[model samples]
Target: MATSTPEELPSSAMTDEDYGAYRASAALWAGTSVLITDQQGKVLVQSVDYRDTRLLPGGAIDKGESPAHGAARELLEELGVHTVVDRGLAVDWVSADSSGAPAAMRFPGELIHVFDGGTWNDEQIAAIRLPESEITAVDFVAPARLPDLLSPADARRALAALRARINAAGTVLLENGHPIAPTSLDRAGILRTPRARHHFTFHTAPVPDTLALRQSWGWVFAPDGRILLLLEPDTGAPCLPGGTPEPHDHGDATTTLHREAIEEAAARIARTTYIGYLSDPAASCARARYAAVLTAVGAAPVDAATGRTYIRVLATPEQALQQFDWGPAAADQLAAVHQARHRLGIPRAAQQPVTELASPITW
Candidate 1:
C-alpha cells in the first residue's frame, strides 16, 4: 500500500476518544494511606476539610510514583511530616459497587496501599505543620476509638494495619477493607492460644477490644539476651513473671506487668510492649501478654512474700522452649513473641555458650 501522510490518516483513528478507550482498565482509582504511630502506639489520623470523617495522612498516587513514595509525599504535602515509610502494612482492593449505589458511574474499582510511617515522639508530633486548606486538624487517636471516628471500611483497614504494626508480622491483605481470610497473624497463631475443653478456650476480646484479659504477664528479658522464666519448685512448670492484678495495679496492662515483675521476679522493667492476649473461656479468665526489657534492677534468689527459694533461669527463647515446659498456654505466648521479634527485626543480645549453662545454681 502507498504510504499516507500524517494529515491523510483516517479521521476516526486519530480521535482522543479512541486513545482514552484503549487506556481504560478495570480500576478507576489508586490511592495510598500512611499509618503513622506515636511512641505509645496511638495512630495519627487527620480531619480533612473535604470530609467530616478523619483519614490517614495520604492521597492518590500520582503518575510514575510508587505507592510507598506517594504515601510519604502526601504526608509531606498535607502535614509537613518528614518521616520515612518503614514497611507496607496493608493493601485493599475495593469494588465500586460495594461503595454506594451510584458508584459505577464514577469509576470501576479502587486500590489502596497502606504503609507504616514508623513511631514519633511527642515533640515530633508537635512539630507537624498542617495545611489548613486541606487538613483541618491532626491528632493522634487510640486504636480503640478509630472505629467511632472513621467509616466502617476505613476503620477496618486501619485496625488491620494497627494489628500488623503491633505484632510486627508482615503486611495484611484486604478486600473491601476486611482481611482476606487467614491472615499472617491467623496463620502464625500469634494471638490464638490453644484451646482445650476443660483447661482453656481462646476467644477474642470484645469490650474495650485492646486486650483479652485484665490480668497480664511479661516475658522480661535480661541484658544477656535471655528471658526470665520462673520455676515452680514442686511441679517444675515454667511461667512468665506475672500474676493477677492487685488493687494497686493501676494505669494500663504494662503498669500491672511492672508491678508483677517487681513482686514475682524482683526486677524492674525499663520498657514494655503489648504483644497480645490469651483468653481461657473455660475458667472465665483472660491474660494480657507483654514483652519487656529489664531495667538496672536484678532479681532476688528468693521471694520475700513466700520465703521460698526460687529457681529462676535466664534462657534463650529456643532453650526456654526446649528446657522448661511452659505448658501449652505459656508456651504459645513465648512462641508468639519469638515470632514477632524475628519478624520485626529486633536483634537478640549476645548469647552465652551452651557450655557456660552447665553450672548449678547457688545462693
Candidate 2:
C-alpha cells in the first residue's frame, strides 16, 4: 500500500487554535472550578449572564496560570472571597461539542479541575460581592436539588464531587460527568431519590422484654466500627436492617436481630445491645433500635423472603445520617448509636465515603 502524501492527507477535525504558529492543530482547552459549601453542606452555585443553567463558581485558566491558582483567582473574582483553594476533588474530561453552547464560546473539549473550597460560615456567605457583569446572582442549594438547576452533565459531576468530598475518598477522575469504576454511592444509587420523612418517638430505655414486639432494627458496627447500612431495594433509601420477629424468632429482639441480619445482609452479628425504640403510630408498630458488633459479613446472598439481595454499605454514623431524613429524632438516634459504640469499645470510623460491601450489588 502506498503511503498518503501531505497533499492528499485531510486536515484534522479539531478546534481552531495556534493558527499553525507553534504545534499541530488540536481542540483542547483547560479550565478550573471550586466546589464551595456552606456550614450546612449546601453547595454554592452561580447564575451567570451568558447561560440559562447555573454553575459552580469558576472560569477558564488564564495563560501561565496553574489550575489550582486559577481556581483561587476565579473564586476571588466571582465571589469576592479571598479564600485560596488547592485540594483537588474532581477532574472531568469534557468531550468536544459546540452545537449546544453559546456561539462565542467555540466549545473546545475541556480539562476541568474542581477543587475543594471548604465550608463557609454565614458571615462569609453574607459578604459575597458580585461584579456588574457575568455572574448575575449566587445561591447555596441542597445537593439533592442540584439536578433541577444545573445541566444534566453538570449535576452528575457536581454530585459525584460532593460524594467524594463527603467520603473523603480522594480526587475522583471523570469523563462526561460519570465515574469509570463507580463508587459505592454510585453503585447503590445513593441520593437518586429524595429522602423520605420519618416521624417517630425515640425512647432511650432498653425495650422491655414484656412489651409485645413488632419491629426491630439497629446500627450494626463492622469489625472496623463503621455502621452497616442497607438500601431499600424498591426505594433506594438507606435503612438499618431488621424487621418484625418471625415465628422462629421466639419474640426476642436479639434473636430477631440475628435472623434478620442474616436475611438482609448475610451478616452474623454478635454482642447485641438494645439502645432504644421508635414508635411510629402511623405504622402501628414499635421498632426496637439496637447496636451490635459484626461477627462476620458474608457476600450478599439473595434474601429468602424478598428474593432480592440488598446493596450493603459501611458508613460512619454521620454519613449514614445524611442519607436519611429522620427529622429531629435522627439526631437522638445518632447520639444513641455513638453511646452504644462507646459501650461496645468500638472505635469511631475514620472519615471516608460510604463503601460497598463487596457482593453482587443488588440495586
TM-score of each: 0.51, 0.78
Q: Please report how far candidate 1 places residue 266 from its true position, in Å.
A: 24
lDDT of 2 by residue, 55-134 (tens): 99888998889999999899889989897687999999988772266659777688889889988888999999998899
lDDT of 1 by residue, 1-363 (tens): 211443443356455554444446333688999888775446799998877789988889999888878988998999897767758988899888776636446857789999988778778888899875988888886566687888778887887776565444467788988778544332322212221222232222332454345577776766556677665454344466777776666546677788766666566776577676766555455677777775544535466556654445565665444333233454455567765455444557444421111133221
Runs in model 2 with CA error above 4 Å?
A: 1-24, 38-41, 102-104, 120-124, 199-215, 232-236, 244-251, 277-287, 304-307, 327-332, 352-354, 359-363
In order of listing, the candidates' clash counts read 0, 1
**Most TM-score-accurate candidate:** 2
- What C-alpha RMSD separates each model from the true structure? 15.9, 6.2
